[model samples]
Each structure stands twice: as C-alpha cells, then as structure tokens.
Target chain A: MIYLLLFWEFFKIGLLAVGGGLVTVPFLFDLTEEYSWFDKRELIDMIAIAQSTPGPVGINMATYAGFNAAGIGGALLATLSEVLPAVIIVYYIAKMLKRWQDSPYVEKVLKSIRPAVIALILFAGLDVAKETVVDWQTAAVLVVLCAAMRLYKKSPFFYIAASAVIGLILKI
Target chain B: MVGLWQIYCLFFKMGIFTFGGGYAMLPILQSEVVRKRHYVTEDELLDYYSIGQCTPGIIAVNAASFIGYKLRGLGGLLSATLGVISPSLVIIVLIAMVLRQYMDNQYLQWMFGGIRISVTALIINTVWDMWRKSVVRVRDYIVFAAAFGLMWCCGLSAALIVLLAAGAAFIPDIRRLKK
Candidate 1:
C-alpha cells in the first residue's frame, strides 16, 4: 500500500512539474505538509543535496524522499514513476514532432508559457528565500552566495563547497 | 563509430559534473556532443533543449533521452537515461545513508544551514536570469504579473497555473483562426 501510494504521488509530480526540476519544489512542499514522508526542514536538506549532487534535481530529490519514506525499494519505485511520463510523452512527441514543430498554435502556446514559467521560477526563488534566511547570518550567507554566483559562471559546486567550509569555520 | 557503450560513458562523465541542475549541463553538452563527437549538430541540440523545456521532466534528462532516441532508438534511449542517472543512484543512496546516520551532528547542521542559504541564493539568480529572457513586451509583463498574483494570492495548484496560462495564450490564436 505504501509502495502504491509512493508511485501515485510521484506520478502526479512527474505529470505536472513542467518547465524543469525546480518547479517540483512546490509540489514536494505540499507533500511534506500532508504526509509524514519528511518534514519541512528535511525539505531544505533535500534541496541542498539535490542541487549539490549529480543528475537532475527532480530525480535526486525523488530518490531521497522515497528512500526516507520507505526504503531502497521505494526509491526505485518513485524514481521510475517520476520518469515514466517523460519517457512515454517524449516518445509520442518524437513521432509527431515534425507536424507540431511548425504549428502557429503550438508556437503561441509555448510563447505564452514563458511568462508563466518565469513566474514559477520566481516563485521557486521566493519559496527558498522564505524557508531560509532566519537571521543575520543566514541573510549574509545568501548575499555572499548571490555575489559568488558569477565566479562559477553557472556550475554551483564551487559556491556550495565554499559555503560548507565557511559554515564550519564560523560554527554557524 | 559511436557505440552504445561510448554514449553511456560520455553521458556518465557529464552526469558527475552536472551540478546546479540542467542549465549547468549546456557547456558540457556543447563541448562533448558538439565539439568532440560531432554526432549531434548545434541546431539539434538547441531543439532538444526547447523540446525538453516544453516537456515535463528534468531538462537535462529529457534532452539526453531525446538525443539517445535519435542516435540508437529504444536501446540508446535506455542506455543514455541510465547513464545520466547512474551517478545520482550510486552517490545519493550512499550519501543518504551517511546523512541519516549523522543528520544531527552539530557541525553538519551548521554546514547545512549555510548551504541552504547559498542554495536559496542560487535559485534567486535563476529567477533573475529567467526573467530577462521570459518577460518582454507589455502582454508578457501582464501575464507574468497575473501568474505571479494568481499563485501568491489564490494559492492555485501547478496544473491549474499551467492550464490557465496556456489557455490564455491560445485565445488569440484560436480567435484569429476563427475570423
């Protein structure tokens, strides 16, 4: 029963968490609130782990959440469930892609989605800001991180690693 | 002669360096797939990215799967997808165990706190980057505000947000067609 619930829940995440992986954060937040799968703080740790690790953020988070919720079995089941929709949908898309690629309606819809996707991305940023930054130290850390964003160009490992070291030194 | 094993190994190496999610993979994709292999064209790679964006999944994984499908059909798709995730599966499982064992260690807690703040910062950067690209012109700004307002105020689910936004876009196209 737990396994079934796991698949169903993650499948819903896979179906709707469009525009990439960060978009899944709100859904996972909803899950945390509803179930004892993990708590609010664990969500923070999960995101940290997800971002710092290799692979897609969505898959990594799903694996961590699933492992916590059930076990290794739950991890595999949840990961598979999250991936199934993308695989099937991509297959159909590849088949009919030539037809839809040129459609004005499709272009319009995609164009329209841009603003909405931007909103979602902005919300994801706000959501993280809300959860963290409880005091001056954390606030300072956030500021430093934003500044450090440029040094790495895009990959965040350097920033993440540097943050961990700073935290250890400051005992924060 | 790019064999299945070679494709798997290339993506596996890419997987290890895929920090900060899909956006971080672009440089790797260009150098490895475009420059070194010459298997995937620049245009094809861009198409994979756009299609990956419109599709529901991790953009990197979606693009990898598409490339895999193009290269070697079903088998290639499976190999590439598995290769991409191999690092996550092995590393996360190991880390999860260790983290569970020491989740409450004092230094670890402090480190996590700091890391969380930085992760939050990185996300904020993503927001600014996306905003510049996505929000343009008057209508786009209005939709951006509307979408943001709807979620901030109404607390709508993701499915609903996607539906309404896409629906709003379709209105003009459908109306024009009818006329």
Candidate 2:
C-alpha cells in the first residue's frame, strides 16, 4: 500500500515538475506536510546528498525519500514511477520531433527557444550563486575555476574532483 | 548505427558525472555527446533541452530518453533512461542505508560546499557556450532578456516563460506568412 502511495506521489511529481530536478524540491516539501515518510530536515539532508553525489538530483532525492518510506522496495518503486512519466512523454515528443525537424515553424520556434532556454539556465546559475557564493573564499574558488575551465578543456569530472580535494584541504 | 548497450553506457557515465541537475548536465553532454561521440549535433542537443524543459518529468531524464529514442528506438529509450537512473538507485540507496549517520560531519559539509562552487562555475561555462551557439539575432537578444527578467524578477515559472517565448516567436511567423 505504501508502495502504491509512493508511486502516486512521485509520479505526480514527475508529471507536474516540468522544468528540471530542482523543480521537484517544492513538491517534496509538500510531501513532508502530507506524509510522515520524511521530515523537512531529512529532506534538506537528502538534497545535500543528492547535490554532492553524481546523478540527477531529482532521481536521487526520490530514491532516498522512497527508501526512507519503505526500504529498498520503496526506493526502486519511486525511481521507476518518477521516470515513467518522462519515458512515456518524451518518447512521443521525440517521435513527433523527427517529423517536425524540417518544418520551418519548428525551426523558427526552436531558434527563439534556444536563447530563452539559455536565459533560464543563466537564471538557474544565478540562483545557485546566491546560495554558494557566500564569502570571498568561495567567490575566489568560483572565479579561478571558471578561468581555469575556460583555458583548459577537461572533463567536468576532473574539475569537480579537484574542487572536492581543495575543499577538504582548505576545510571551506 | 549505435547499439543499445552503447547508449546505456554513455548515459550511465553521464549520470555518474552530472551534479546539481539538468542544467549541469549540459557541459557533460556538450563534451561527451557532441564533442567526443558525435552522436548528436550541438543544435540537436539544445533542441532536446528546450523540449525537455517544457515536457513533464526531470529535464535530464527527459533529454536522455529523447536522445536514446533518436539513437535506437524504444529499446534505446529504456536503456538510456534506466542507465542514467541506475547510479542514483545504487548510490542513494547505499547512502540512505549506511552513510546517513555521517551526513552531518564537518569535513563532508566543507567538501560539498566546495563542490557546489565548482558546479556553479560549470553552469557559467555552459551559459557562455549556449550564448555563443544560440544568441545570434537581435530578436534572440530581446527574447533572452525578456525570459531572464520574467524568471528572475517576476518569479515566473520556466515552463510559462518558454511558452511565452515560443508564442512571441510564432506571432511574427504568422505575420510573415500573411504578408
């Protein structure tokens, strides 16, 4: 029964949280109010774990929250339910998109959407900056890393790992 | 032709590397998919992201499934989607079981803080790349400013902003067609 409920809740999240991973955070907050599966503090901890680890934060949160609710089964169920909506919806979108690939209207709309989407991504970056760029040390890290990344083309994993070591050594 | 296993492996690697969220996946995708593999062109990637934003579900997952479908079909879609989430399943479950106790440790917190800064830097780099690739026209600039302002100042949701941009672009097309 809890499995069904978990599926329903996360499935709703997948269906409604259209934008991205962080978009699901608010919905999870509401889950804290509705169910005793995970509390607000635990949610924060889950988010921290999700962000620090590799993988999509949304799915990570879902799995963690699900496990909290009903162990391994709950975790598996929630992850599957969460992705099911995406799998089904994007399948059709991809199918139709192929036909529309050459359409002038699709091209024109995509042309405009390209910039708008970039703006949204930039806005997301600013939001993260607001949270992470708290002091001079952190700001320095961001600036230096940005410059270094632009200069040398390396996999993102390399920089991420390097930053983790820097963080550990500096204890910042 | 790309094999389903290859699709799965690529996304699995992407899942392991991605931090933050879908936006953070952009750089990894740009490096791996566009640059290394040549499976999808840069424009196709942006297209997947744009559509993925408006669609239901996680953006990264949506994009993964989309790319998977384009590459192989239903099998590819399942492989890609499953591949990406597999890491989250294993890692989060393990952490939930054992490492929950250590989550509050000071050293880990400091490490995460540093990791967060790096993720931001990555996002900034992605924005630069997208701007270079996408924002060419004066109209595109206007749309960019409008979308950014609406989201930042007005607190409008991203889906609505995308719809508005698409609608605004569509209007001019209608006018051009009538002319």
Candidate 3:
C-alpha cells in the first residue's frame, strides 16, 4: 500500500510538474501537508538537503519523502514514479517532432508556456526567499546576489561561493 | 558491462562534483555528456534542459535519465539514476545519523546559515536568468503574474493552476476551431 501510494504521488508529480524542479516545491508542500509524512521544519531541512545534494531538488525531496514513509524501497519507487511521466512524454514528444517539426501551432503553444514558466520560477524564488531570508542581513545578501546575478554574466556558482564566504565572514 | 560501468562512473563523477544541485549540474553535464562522452549533442542537451525544467524530478537526474535512455535504453536510465544519487544518499545518511544529536550545535547552525544564504543567492540568480530569457511579451507577463498569484496567493494546487493555464491558452484555439 505504501509502495502504491509512493508511486501514485510521484506519478502525479511527474505528470504535472510541467515547469521544472523548483516548481515542484509548492506541490510537495501540499503533499507533505496531506500525508503528514513530514512537517514544515522537516520540509525546510529537506529543502536544505535537496539544495546541497547532487541530484535535482525535486527528486531528492521525493526520495526523502519516500524514505521517511517506507524506507529504501519507497524511495526507489517514488523516484522512479516521479520520472516515469517525463520518460513517457519525452519519448512521444521526440517521435512527434520528426513529423511536426515545422508546425506553427506547436511552436506557438510552446512559446506561450515560456512566460508561465518564468512566473513559476519567480514564485519559487519568492517562496525560497520568504523561508530563508528571515532577517535584514539575509535580505541584504539576497538583494546583493540578485543584483550581481542581473548585472554579471558569470556562472552562478561564483555568486554562491562569494556569498557563502561573505556570510561566514560577517557571521550572519 | 564495461560500458555500463563507464556510464556509471561518468555520472558518479558528476554527482560528486556538482555543489548547488540541479542547475549547478548543467555545465558539468554539458561538458561531460555532450563534449567528452559524445553521448548527446549540444542541441539535445539544451532540449533536455528545457524539458527537464518542465518535468518532475531533479534536472540533473532528469538529464541523466534522458541521456542514459538515449544511450542505453532502460539499463542506461537505471545506471545513471543510481550514479547521480549514490553520493548524496551516502552522505545524507551519514549526516543524518551522526548529526542527529548535534543538529542544534552552534557550528553546524553557523555553517547552515552560510549555506542557506548561498542557496538563496543561487535560486535568485536562476530566477533572474529564466525571467530575462523567457518573459518576452505582455501576455507572457500576464500568464506569469496569474500563475504566481495562483501558486502563492490563492494557495491553489500547482496541478490545477497549470491545467487552468493550459486550458486558458487553448480557449482561443477551441473557439477558432468551432467557428
């Protein structure tokens, strides 16, 4: 039953996570609330783990949720289920592209999804900011980072590393 | 078997090296998979990135699955996923066990404080880049605003929000077809 639940939860996520990893965070928040598998604080901890880890944040969170629910097998099922939708969708999308590569309607529909994706990303940024930036110093770091990101074309890691160093030095 | 091991090693290296998670893994994946391994092309990597963005799971894992599936079918996907996850699983489990009692330790708290600040920056950076490249028109802005409002303000389900947006986008097409 737990395996089935894990599979179904992630299957839904995989099917509808149409805007990326960060976009799935809000959905996971809802899931956590619904299932009581983890609480808000644990969710925050999971986010930290997810951010620091190697895989996608969404996948890591799914794995964490599954692990919390029913151990390793649950984790495996959840991760696989979360990815199944994409594998299926991409396979079909690739096959269809050969035939409809020049279809204007398809092109236009994809283009229309762009703005919504951006909005979703922005909302994610705000949600992260609300959770992490609890005080003035953190807010300052966020502002400076956003400015650096906007003005410079350097890799994001540069800013991330710089901010880490600065935060350590300032002891914030 | 050797090829499978090689694929596993390649993704394991990526997993171990990437610091800031999915978005951070992109350049490494681009170099290793596309340039070095020659498993995928530059264009395919970009498409994977775009699709990975819209899909569930981590971008890094999604990229691995997509690339692996392209290269070696189901076996490729399994190996790649395992490789990408192995480092984090081992590390997180160790940390969870050892640091369970010391979670509130001052040094650990300070370290996390620093990391949290850094992660926020990385996330904001991602938002800025995605916005600059993707948000082109007023209609796009409207969609973004609407989606953000739905997700953050109304606390609507993401699934519903996306479905609503897709439905909204299709309305004119439906109308034209009916006419």
- TM-score top scorer: 2
Q: How does chain B score by TM in each prediction?
A: 0.58, 0.92, 0.62
Error in Å for residue A126 of model 2: 1.1
lDDT of 2 at B153: 77
Better of 1 and 3 by TM-score: 1
What would the per-residue lDDT of candidate 1 be over residues B1-179, giving only the tens digit for each residue?
A: 55799779878987776655565565567557775678786546655665676678777788888878778876777778878877777777878887555656788877766665666776677557556766775677878899899989998754467667778884554445788
Which is the leading candidate under lDDT?
Answer: 2
Interface RMSD of each: 4.6, 1.2, 4.5
Task: Please give, for residues A87-120, the per-residue lDDT of candidate 1 as tens digits.
Answer: 8888677667546857888767667766776676
The model with the greater DockQ, 1 or 2, is: 2
Expressed as tens digits, the lDDT of each residue in A1-172 for candidate 3 is 8788788988998777765456667778888778977888888887777665545566677777777777767676777787777766655555565467477875555556655555554565566567678889888877776676668755544554576577667676
Model 2, runs deviating above 4 Å: B173-179
The TM-score that candidate 3 achieves is 0.66
Recovered native contacts, candidate 1: 0.63
Candidate 2 local lDDT, B54-74, one digit each (tens): 889888998899889988989
DockQ of each: 0.43, 0.81, 0.33
What does the lDDT read for residue B119 in candidate 2?
Answer: 86
Q: Estimate each model's TM-score.
A: 0.67, 0.94, 0.66
Which ten contiguous residues of candidate 1 chain B have the minimum total lDDT? Answer: B19-28
Which residue segments of model 3 deviate by more than 4 Å?
A1-58, A61-101, B1-60, B63-80, B97-103, B167-179
Give the per-residue lDDT of model 2 (tens digit) for A1-172.
8988999999999898888867899999999999999999989988888987889989999999999999999999999999998899898888898988999998988888889899988998888899999989889999999999999999888888898898998788
